[model samples]
Structure formats: C-alpha cells, structure tokens
Target: MDITVAEALVRCLEQEKVEIVFGYPGGAILPVYDALNHTSIRHILVRHEQGAAHAADGYARVTGKVGVCMATSGPGATNLVTGIANAYMDSIPMIIITGQVATSQVGTDAFQEVDITGITLPITKHNFLVKDPAKLPVIVKKAFLIAATGRPGPVLIDLPKDIAQARIKFKYPKTVELTGYKPTYRGHPSMVQQAAGLIMSSERPVIYAGGGVRISNAAPELLQLAETISAPVTHTLMGLGCFPGNHPLFLGMLGLHGTRYANQAVTECDCLIAVGARFDDRVVTKVSGFAPSAKIIHIDIDPAEIGKNVRINLPIVGDVKNVLGAILPLLKKKENGAWVARVQQLKKDYALRYDRGGMLKPQYVLEKLNEFKDDDAIVVTDVGQHQMWAALYMRFKEPRSFLSSGGLGAMGFCLPAAVGAKLGAPHRTVIVVIGDGGIQMTMQELGTAAEQKLPLKIFVLNNQRLGMVRQLQEFYCEKRYFGVDFQFNLDFTALGRLYGMEGYTVETEEQLLEILPRVLTSPEGVIVNCIVDPEENVYPMVLNGSPINEAID
Candidate 1:
C-alpha cells in the first residue's frame, strides 16, 4: 500500500514504539501533523517549540526512551536549539523532527525556510535532510538508533514539505547499519585488572560518578564497587540520584557549590576512580590542584573525554556498567577504617548549613520539601540558586529521580520539563523547583500542563532577583548589583490561577508549613509561590582559580 511520506513517518514512529510526541504545528509541518491526527501516539501541543523540545527531553530522562519532538521551519525550528543543546550536553536521548521548505525551494529562502540541519550540526549526534521520500523510514530508524545507543544524545531529521507530501510504499527498516559508528561496550581485561589492583592497593580512594552512571544503568554495580572497597563516593551534579543520597559512604556532590567534605575527600584521596564523568572545569575547579594526591582512573564510553580535560593515569574506554562489572570481581574487600573515619569526620564538620531563624530561605524550603515529599518523587529543577539548594537538600534513592539542565544550565527548564515528566511517569509524583527568573522564561508552559490536566506540584522560589548571578557579582564585582534584581516581580500564585490551577503564596516558615501539606496532597495541579530571601546565596562556593576543597561559605 502506498502512503504519503508523512503517513510513512507516523508508521515509522509506531514501529519504534513511540508512545508520545511533544510538538507544535506550523505551515511547513502541516501534512505530518494531519497524518498524526489518525495515530494512537499521544501528541502534546506545546505553546512554543522550545517547550516541545524540553518536554521531550524530560520524558526521555524519566522513561529511558528516545523522546520525540517536532516543529516547523524557520523560527519554529530555530526555537528548538536551546533544548536540543541541553539534551546534547546532558547526554539525553532525543529525536528532533523539523519541517523544512519544499525541496524545490531549498536555498531559495522560501517562506518559513531555514537550514535547521546546518545550524544544529555541532549539537547533534547525527542529523539528516530528507530530500528523498523513500528514505524517510530509514532515516527515522537510523535517528532512533543513533540517539538511544551508547553515550546517547540528540539526533535530528529535517523533512522538506514536498518530501512529506510525496507518496511511497511504506517499509520501516528493522535494523540500522551505520559504518564508523560502533560504540565500545566492554573494557579490556588487562585494564580492568589494573584498575582493580589500584583499588586494592590504595588506602584512601574515592569514586567520582557522573551522569553516565544513570545513562548506563550502572548504579547497582557502582554501589557494589563502593561497598566492596569501602570507598567514599562523590557525585557530579548530573550524577545525584545514581547512588542513594542517604548512604553512609555517599559524599554529597563534589566541586562548585559542592559539599565541602566531598571536595576535601577528593583532594586527599590516593586513587580517584572516575566512572562515566568528564572532568569539567566546574567539577575540577583548578585542574592543577584537583585530586593532586590521586592517581586518576577514567572509565567512559566516549574515549575523547578520557584525557580531554584532566590527565588520566589509566583510561578504560567502555560502557560504565560493563567496565565496573569487570573491575568488581578482580578486587578483594577492604577495611579502610582510618580513611572511612576521616570521611565521616569531614561529613560532620562541613555539612551544608543555612540560617533557619531568619526570613524565608530557599534551603529551608527545599529541606522541608524533602521531608514532605514521597521518597520516589521526581524533582526537576531549572538552573540557579534554587537548583543548587534542591541538589543539596533533596534525598533521591533511585536513578532518573533528579533531572536538571546540568551541562547547559539552561533556565526556564523546570515547568515544561515537569509537564513532560508527569506525562512520562504519570504514576509517580513530579515536582518543579525553579527560580522567579527561570519560571518567567517558560511560565507559558503552564497552559500546556493545565490542558493535559497534569497534577504537577510546582514551587517557585521567588527571590525577585537573578540570584545566582547576583551572588557572583557580590563575590567578584564589589557588589555593584547591576541588572540582576527584578524591580517588579509577578505574583506567581495569581498567574497559576489564570491557568485554572490552585495557587498559594508563602512568605514565612509558618505559612510554608501550613501550605506545603495541602498542596503536596492535592489531586489537582497547584503552584506555591515561595517568597525566599533575596540575599541568601548557595554556599561552599569555590572561588575562581582555587581548588574545590578551598570553598567559602
């Protein structure tokens, strides 16, 4: 049976078992949207193309699938850039479909035409411009395969208007074959043995885990490795929920805005086993001083990242889970009692602290939120002080429970992401913690949530300032305090009401305590506008050029 290329595209999505697609319609993409009307795959209509991309990103993170998002040409396709970059930076698997101008109009700059594939080249794992209608199914198959494979990232497919309208006999490819793109899954036995020997020999060792742990589903293996060797574990921001936050051996997040103790442990450890983590500048503070005493062993699927930032004493290029599994058995159990005692002492001495007696603080709100929410609740945050506070305060016991814009640090991520997360994991509670500035960036997404009737518990930490940048100014610019403060802050609770959701504003601990329980247990969506102190800043911050351990509160 011959079908329009647009129909064939839908069939390809069905073949891939795609349950939901987040998108916005426009003229260039009309045929695909029309064909989608006949499918069982749920299509979430977002107000903006960026929201659609972020929604798909959130869905992918929570569900461990290739999230799909679509948009039309020109501004519509360009608007998806930030979200695509966010997914690329975090290693999230996503398929971005964009509609281009007709094939004949290529290079003519026809109405609503743009070179989306060219613009997204550096940010995507792979991308295709579909000029041939017969190749749409194969392109989609390859896109999915590339996006969801080892060291996952976003892949794009740009369908010209004419290509979508063209007729083709539908045949979704069952397998994909792409040359020069094989991913290594198994570590060499000799390298694994050497890593085990190093682990067995070192008296003070620390496991530095990152987002790859979650991507590779290596948390169980990581936990076993840490326990068997009795090594303290410190995580990168993207790695928060990969290990149980409450575990005794868990040193909280390490590096900028990291726990002082986690940073200190890394500084003093004799061996640093970096699993699936790139040594980003934020995490490595001053590379010369970072893990100065440790011999570094890096395990990652991407070989380019092994020695790209920090010098690695040993590099094991393979899947995190596979590498850790191989290294686990070659090691003997250790009782590094003195090192364990030292780490425990550090944890106690440098525990996160904030003033609780003063006016509302973001940290206090997050601590209380942690106490009130279910252990399995999914917490998604936009970047800023509120994001750091959430990372420091929340306790996550499972992978994918904590989602944030880690690498890109994109603002305006929380609301739309929460919408996608709730849709992806409807059975689980989804919460959004974002700052006033970030919420305003994508607050329009509230309409999408309302239409979907998603019961998302949103908390806007209303600081009335770009809090993170304001803190930076205080530290580096003699407190000039330029351009960061919001002279007129929106009433978030009132804004929620406009979207047909209940809303509340809390300015004090008493008010917060009063409102938290009710809002948390509510069956309908609700937003709590938390008026946090503007002067409060995320602490244990590493000063520029200083080692991670030498942080100031």
Candidate 2:
C-alpha cells in the first residue's frame, strides 16, 4: 500500500514500540504533525525545543529505552544542540528528528533551513539526512539501532519537507547489518585472567565505578565483585545509585566536590580497579598524583577510552557486566581487614557535616528530603551547588533512581526532565532539586507539568545567586565576586499557583519542617521556594594544581 513518508515514519515508530514522543510543532514539520494525529502514540507539547530534547533524555535514562524527540528546522533545530550534547556526553540513547527545507531549495537557504546533520556531526553517534522516501523506514531502524547499541548516544534524522509529503511503499526492516560496527561484549580471556590476578594479589584494592556500570546494568555484578574481593568502592558523579549508597564498603562519590574519604582511599589504595570508568580531568584532578602508587586495571566497552587520559597497567575492553562476571570465578575471597579498617577510619574522620543551628541551608533541606522520600524515589537535579549537595545527601538504593547532566552540566535541566521521568515511570515518585539560577532558565516547563497533572515535588533552593561560580570567584579571584548575585526575584510560590498548582515558601527551619510533609504528600504538583543561605558553598573542593586528596573545606 502507498502512503505519505510522514505516515510511514509514524508506522516505523510504532513498530519500534515507542509509546510517547516529546516535540513541538512548527511550519516546516506540519505534515509530520498532521500524520501524528492519526496514531495512538502520545505526543507531549513542550514550551521550547530544548525542553523536548531534555525530557527525552530523562525518559531514556529511567526506562533504558531509546527516547524520541522532534523539532522543526533552523532555530528550532539549533535549540536542541545543548540537550543533544548532554545525552552524547552521558551516553544516553536518544533519537532526534528535525524538519528541513524542501529538496528543491537545497543550497539556497530557504525558510527554516539549516544543515542540522552537519552541525551535530561531532556529537552524535550517527545521523541521517533522508532524501529518498522509500528509505525512511530503514533510516529510522538504523538510527534506533545505532543510538541504543555500544556506548549509547544521540542519533539524528533530518527529514526534508518534500520527502515527508512524497508517496512510498513502506516496509520496516526486520534486521539491520552495519559493516565495521560490532561492539565487543566479551573481554579477551587472557586480559580477564590478568585482572583477576591483580585483584587476588593486591592487599589494598579499591573499585572506581562510573556511568557505564549503570548503562550496562552491571550493578549486581559490581556488588558481587566488590563483596567477593572485599574491596572498598568509590564512584564518580555519574556512577551514583549504581552501588548501594548505605553499604559499608561504599566510599561515596570521588572527584571535584566529592567526599574527602573517597578521595583519600583512591589515593592510598595499592590496586585501583577502574570498572566502566574513564579518568576524567574532574575526577583525576592532578593526573600525575592520581592513584600514584596503585596499579590501575581499566575495564570498559569503548576501547578508545582505555588509555586516553591515564596510563593503565591492565586493560580489559568489553562490557562491564561481562568482564566482571568473567573475572569473578577466577578469584578466591580475601579478607583485607586492615585496609577496610583504614578506609572506615577515613570515612569517620571526614564525615559530611553542617551547622545544625543557623539559617536554612541547602544541605539540610536535602538531608530532610532524603529522610522523607521513599528509598525508590527518583531525584533529578539541575547543575550548581544544589547538584553537588543532592549527590552528597540523597541516599539511592537502586539503579536509575538518580538523573543529572553529569558531563555537560547543563542548567535548566531539572523541570522538564522531571516531567518526562514521571511520564516514563508513573508509579515512582519523582522530585526535582534545582538551584535558583537554573530554575529560571527553564521555569516555563511548569505549564507542561500542570497540563499533564503530574504530582512532582519541586524544591527550588533559592539562594538568590549563582553559588558555584561565586565560590569559584571567591577562591580564584581573591573574593572579587561580581555578576553572580541576583538583584531581583520572582515569587516562585505564586508562579506555581499561576500554573494551577500548590505552592509554598520556606525561609526558616520551622517553616520547612511544617510545610514539607504536606507538600510531599500532596496529590497535585507542588513547588517549594526554599530560601537558603546566600553565602553557603559546596565543601571538600579541590583547588587548582592539587591532588584530590588535598581538597579544602
């Protein structure tokens, strides 16, 4: 049967079992929007193109599925760039579709035209510009496959207006075969044995886990390996929630703004087993000083990341779960009693602390949030001091319960992301912890949540300043803080009410304690404007040219 390419595209999406799509309508993509009206797929109308992309990203992180988002040409397509980069850096699977000018206006710069495929080349795992109507189904298939497979990332498809209106007989491909694109799932036998040997022989071993552990769903294997070898575990920012937060062996997050004990343990360990983690500059701090005495055993799916940033004594290139499973049987259990005691001592000595009596603090709010929320609740945070604070205070017992813009550190991510996360996991309680500066960046998303009637607990830590940058200026620029403080503000409580939701203002501990229970248990969406101390900053920060262990409070 013959059908318009736009209709064929929708059919292809249905074939992929896509239940929802986040997008906004525009002139160039009118045909696709018209075709969507006939399908059962739910489409979420976002306030801006960037919100659509971010929402899709959040959806993918929680569901472990390829998230789909769309936008029209030119400015609309350009707006998706930040979100696309965010997904790419974090290895989230996503498919981004953008409308383009008709083929007839190829190089003439027609209305709402831009080379989106070309612009996103450096970031995307793969992208396509569809010129043939018959190939639309196959292109969609390949895009999804590429985005979800082997170190997942964003893939884009540019559909010209003329092609969307063209007629074609659509047949979705049963399987895709891409030459020279096979992912390595199993580690080399010799390398796996060598890694086991290192684990068994070392007296003091520490496991440094990263986002790949969560991406490959290797949390169970990671836990087993850690327990089997009796190694203390420390995680990167993205690796949070992959390991149980309350476990005795867990050293908490390690890196900039990381825990002091985690950094000290990593620095002092004799054998460092880096599972599915890259030696990012933020984590390594002083490259020469990182794991200075440890024999580094690196395991990752992407071979290129093996020796890119740090020297590795042993490299096992394969899936994290597979590699860990292979190495487990080769080793006998060892009781590193002294090493465990040493790490525990460090944990106790540098425990996280804050003033109990003072103005309302962001840390205090997060700790209270942790106490009140369910263990399985999902927390999404925007970048800044609050992000670091949330990472420090929230306790995550399961994987996929925490989501944030780790590598890109994009602001304005929490609100829209919370929207998509709630839609993806309707049974789970979703909360948003965003800073005052970040919330204003995409606060318009409140309308989307209101329309969907999502019961989200949004806590805006209103410090009335860009706290992170101000802290940096305080340290680096000799206390010359400028362009960081906000002179004016909006009534966030009233803003939530304007969207037909419940709102509250919390300035003191009494107010917070009184209102939190009501807001958290509310059936309707609610936003709490928390007035935190303006001068408060994230502690245990690593200064320039200093090793992670030498961080200052």
Candidate 3:
C-alpha cells in the first residue's frame, strides 16, 4: 500500500520504539503533523523549538534511548541549534527531523527556507537531506542507527516539504548496516593484558571515569577494577552518577570546581587509568600541570578522542564495559590499602563545606534535597551555582540518576528537561533544580508540565542574579557587578500557580526543610521558589591558569 512519506516516517518511528516526539508545528511540517494526529506516537507540543530539542535530550539521558525531536524550516529549525549542540558536545543519542521548503524551491530562498542541514553540519555527528520519497524509510532508519551507535550523538534528517507529501510504499528495514561505520566493542586482548599488568605494577592509581561509563553501563566493571587495583575514583561533570557518590573510594568530581582532594590525588597519582572520559579543558584546567606524574592509560570507544585534548601514555579504543569486563578477570587484588587510606584522608581533610547556619543557602537546600531524594529519583539541573551545589551535595547511587547540560552548560535546561524525563521514566520521581536566571529562560515549560499532568518537582534557587557570572566578575573585574543581577526578580511560585500548578516559597532553611519532602510527594506538578543567599559562591574553584590541585574557596 502506498502511503505519504510522512506516514511512512511515522511507521519508521514506531518501529524504532519511539513512543514520543517533542516538537512544534509550522507550515513546512504540516503534512507530518497531520499524519501524526492518527498515530499512537504522542507528540509533545513545546512552547519553543529549543524546548523541544532539550526535552528530547532529557528523555534520552534518563531512558537510555535515542530521543526524537522535530521542527519546521527556517527559524523553527535554527532555534534547535543550541539544544543540538548541547547533545552533540555531551555525546547524547538523539534523532532530529526538520521540515525544509519544497524541492521546487531549492536554492531560490523560498519563504521560510534555510539550509538547516548545512547550518547544523558542524554540530551533528551525521545528517542527511532527503530529496527522494522512495528513500524516506531507509533514511529515517539510518538516522536513528547513526544517532544511537558508535559514540552516540545527534543525527539530523532534513525532509523537504514535497518529499514528505509524496507517496511511497512503506517497508521499514529489519536491520541497518552502515558500511563506513563499525565501532569496536571489545578491546584488543594484548591491550587488555597490558592494562591488567599496569594495575598489578602500580601502587598509586586513580580511575578517571566519564559520561561514557554511564552510556556503556560499565559502573559494575569500573567498581570491580577500582576494588581489584585499590584505586580511588574521580569523575567529570558529565560522569556524576557513573559511580556511587557515597563510595569510600570515591574522590568526587575532578577539574574546575572539583573537590580539592580529588584534584590533589590526580596530581600525586603514579597511574591515571581513564575510562570513557574525554580530557576536556575544563577537566584539564592547566594542561601543563594536569596529571604531571601519572602514566595515563586512556580507554574510550572513539579513537579520535583518545589523544584529541591531552596527551596519553596508553590508548585503548573500545567500549568501556567490554574492555573492563575483559580486564577485570585478569586483574589480581592489590594490597594498596595505604594509598586508599591516603585518598580517604584527603577526602576527609578537604571535605565539601558551606555555611550551615545561614538564610536558605544553596548548598543547604541541595543537602536537604538529597535527604528526600529516592535512590532512583532523577535529578536534572540547569547550569550555574545550583548545578555545582547538586554536584557537590547530592548522593547519586545509580546511572542516569543525575542529568544536566555538562558540556554546553546550557542555562534553561532543567524545567523542560524534567517534563521529558518524567514522561520517559513515568514511574520514577523527577526533580529539576534550576537557578533564577535559568528558570526564567524556559519557565514557560511549566504550562507543558501542567498540560501533561506530570508530577515533577521543580526547585528554583532564587539568588536574584546569574550566580556563576557574578562569581566570575568578582574575581576578574574587581567586583564591579554588571548585567548579572535580576533587578525585577519575578515570583516563581506565583508563576507556577498561574500555570495551574501548586507553588510555594521558602525564605529560610527551616521552612525549606519542612516543605521539601512534601513537595517531592506532590501528586500534581509543583514548583518551589527558595530564596538563596546571593553572596554565596561555589567553593574549591580552580581559577584561571591554576593547576587543578590548588583551588580557591
């Protein structure tokens, strides 16, 4: 039976197990939207195209599935750029489908016409411009496959209006094979053996894990390797929940705004075994001073990333889980108890601290939030001081429990992300901790949550300023604060109520402590506006040109 390419596209999505698509409707994509009206696949109408992309990204992180998002041509497609870049930089799996002008209008700059595939070429892992109706099914399948495999990232499909409306016989492929792309899953046997030998010979070693650990589901293997080798573990911002935050051997996050002890341990370690982490500049604050004495063994699925950012002594290109699984059995337990003790001492000596007796400090709110958070609760964060506080104080014991815009450091991520996360993991509690500045960026998503009747806990740290920017100005510009303060700070609780959700405002620690638990249990969507101290700063910050070990509080 012949069906419109739009209908065939929907069939492909169904085959891919795409239960939802976050999108906005426009003229160019009318046929697709019209087709979607009859399908079981739910479409979430976002207030903005950017929200749609972020919602899909949030869904991907929590569910470990390739997220789907769509938008029309021109401004609609361009609006998805920031969110697409966020997914690309963080190595998220997402499939973005955008409608383009009709094939007849190609290169003439028709109404609402723009080269989205060209615009997004640099950011996407791969992208396609579909000019033929017959190839729609294959292209859709390929897009999802490319997005979900081989160091996952966003892939885009630009469907011209005429092709989407054209007729095609629908037949979704059972499997896809991209001839030019095949990722290595297992590490070379010799490399695995070499890793085991290095573990046996090293006395002082640390495991630097990253987002890849969570992506590969290698936490158990990572734990076994750490335990067998008696190594402490530290992670990047994107790697928050790859290991249990409360583990004794855990050294917290490493790099800028990292724990002082974690950075110190990295500085002094003899062997740095890196798994599934890219040595991003933020993680290597001063390249010359980073891991100066360590014999670095970098393990990642992407060979290009092995030496792209920082020099490595050994490079193993394979899936983190598979490589660790191979190496774990060969590894013998070492008696590096003394090194473990030293790492623990460092953690204890330079523990994360903040004002406990203050008016609703951000850190205190996060600590209190930790108490109410279930082990399985998904905590999403927008960028800035609140994100840092969550990183420092929240106890994450499972992968996907902590999701944020790590690489892009996007400000307006949490609120809309929480909506998609709740939909993705319907049974789990989803909490979005955002700052005043970030919340205002996408606070309009509150209406989406209310419409969906999602019971998300939205916590806003109302500092009345862009906290991170203010902190930077204090250090760099002699404390002459500029453009960061919200002079007309709106009441977030009132805004939530306006969106038909429950709302509350807490001015003190005691007031927040009493309300947070109940807020977490709210049956309908709710928002809590906590007035936090503006003077507070995220401590243990590694300043510019400073080594990761020496931080300023």
Clashes per candidate, residues 3 or more apart or on different chains: 0, 0, 0
TM-score: model 2 vs. ground truth: 0.99
After TM-score superposition, what is the CA distance of residue 368 in candidate 2 from its true location, in Å?
0.7
Candidate 1 lDDT by residue in tens digits, 1-553: 8999999999999989999999999999999999999689999999999999999999999999999999999999999999999999999999999999999999998999999999999999989999889989989999998999989999999999999999999988788789978999999889998999988999999999999999999999999999999999999989999999989999989999899999999999999999999998889989899999999999999999989989999999999999999998888889899999999999999989988877798998999999999888999999999999999888899889999999999998888888899999998999899999999999889999999999889999998999999999999999999999899988888899999889999999999999888888889888899998999989989999999989997
> lDDT scores for all predictions?
0.93, 0.92, 0.90
Worst 10-residue lDDT window for candidate 1 reads 350-359
Instruction: Give per-residue CA lDDT, model 2, range 205-251, as digits (tens).
Output: 99999999999999999999899989999988889998999999998
Residue 365 CA displacement from its true place in model 3, Å: 0.6
| True-structure RMSD for candidate 1 | 0.8
TM-score sort, best first: 1, 2, 3
Runs off by more than 4 Å, candidate 3: none
The alpha-carbon lDDT assigned to residue 369 of candidate 1 equals 97
- Note each model's CA RMSD in angstroms: 0.8, 1.0, 1.1
The runs of at least 3 residues in candidate 2 whose Cα sits more than 4 Å from the true structure, single-residue gaps closed, are none
